[model samples]
Target: MEGQLDHHPTPLGNWLEDLFAKLFYQPDDEICKKAMKEEMSPQLKVCINGQHVPREGFDQVITEARRTYNISVQNSRELLASPDATDKGIGSVAHIQTFTLEDKKTGNQRKQTSLTISVIAFSDGGKQLIELVEIVLDH
Candidate 1:
């Protein structure tokens, strides 16, 4: 997919864009920590393919994964996105993003695309935070 940055029209859109961009450039522990502390809600949960990751383990799983794979964004496309469409200050996005993952030890690299959908809701202070994330690898 041809990488494009012309679709972020809302806070959720911008958040998704920023998330990928951060990983593309950094792909480090800092990004993972930042995502967990600043972006993901304390109650946040993630579903990868069919595996479920509860809030208690979300940070550890993600942090370990980030450390394991040197991932860089190759391209991204928004399949569907919305801004507060439900009048409950809720936003959602469905996207397909391509990334290049390199193994640190083996020095092997491959490109993979994943279909991801994320739900965002406004916090009490009016900041948008990711509440749920679902991703299907090799999609």
Candidate 2:
């Protein structure tokens, strides 16, 4: 933790809420899709349960989830956040949450509570974005 910033912030709630809403309910909205691009880095790295995944694959999962299930956020927590070393007031944010995914076509459901930690930063165009994320889940 020596190199990490000390601040803890959860200001991305609105952004997260919007992401889920648009991702699940409005997948075809051009404006929303355009805006969503600004929220994550093009070179984003995601590790779910210790398995690395590419950005394209990540987006596929989102698409699959949108088409296959109705996801409900049963519980959530903003564990921590810190600013970048440049003091631009951006760094990483962590959240732990339980989600209920009800199958869209089959009516089956599942819970996979997960802990997600993401490093956020300003892109070259001054847009806030998630660059790297690590996810651990309890099934």
Candidate 3:
């Protein structure tokens, strides 16, 4: 039952949830850096709003988010999970995230969106590390 879904933090599902909480909701740079270093594969691919973002472009996305949104994320809830049939180790989850953003000179704005996050867990030195992340914007 090593890969069983009955576990409290079903390997792939739990890790993906935590990753999104840190990257999108909390916005912790150090944690994000560490997660990327330790969890993600070197050939990671990320897509947002239907556009593919090469691994190297991740920093730019982070920078843009910081500049445009100064956001505080709240009410993050995992809505659904879809496990991959072809790969038992892969899973995807739909999450509802709520957040508020403020521009010091402008005003405050609140928004909520559903995001689908997909993760692939693969063995690296006997430890399962997340090798792929495919994030989809759910409108």
Question: Pick by TM-score: which candidate is best?
Answer: 1
How high is each candidate's TM-score?
0.75, 0.73, 0.62
Over 92-138, each residue of candidate 3 has an lDDT whose tens digit, in order, gives 55555666666645776656454656555564532233333444342
Over 19-137, each residue of candidate 2 has an lDDT whose tens digit, in order, gives 54565545465644565576767787878777888988877777677778877778766666654423554666666678788888889888877677766667857545565465645
Judged by lDDT relative to the true structure, which candidate is superior, 1 or 2? 1
lDDT of each: 0.67, 0.65, 0.57
The better candidate by TM-score, 1 or 3, is 1
* Candidate achieving higher TM-score, 1 or 2: 1
Candidate 2 local lDDT, residue 68: 82
Clashes of each: 0, 0, 0
Q: Which parts of model 1 have CA positions greater than 4 angstroms off?
A: 1-11, 23-25, 83-90, 124-126
Error of 2 at 37 (Å): 1.9
Ranking by TM-score: 1, 2, 3
| Shift of residue 62 alpha carbon in model 3, Å | 2.2
**Candidate 1 global CA lDDT score:** 0.67
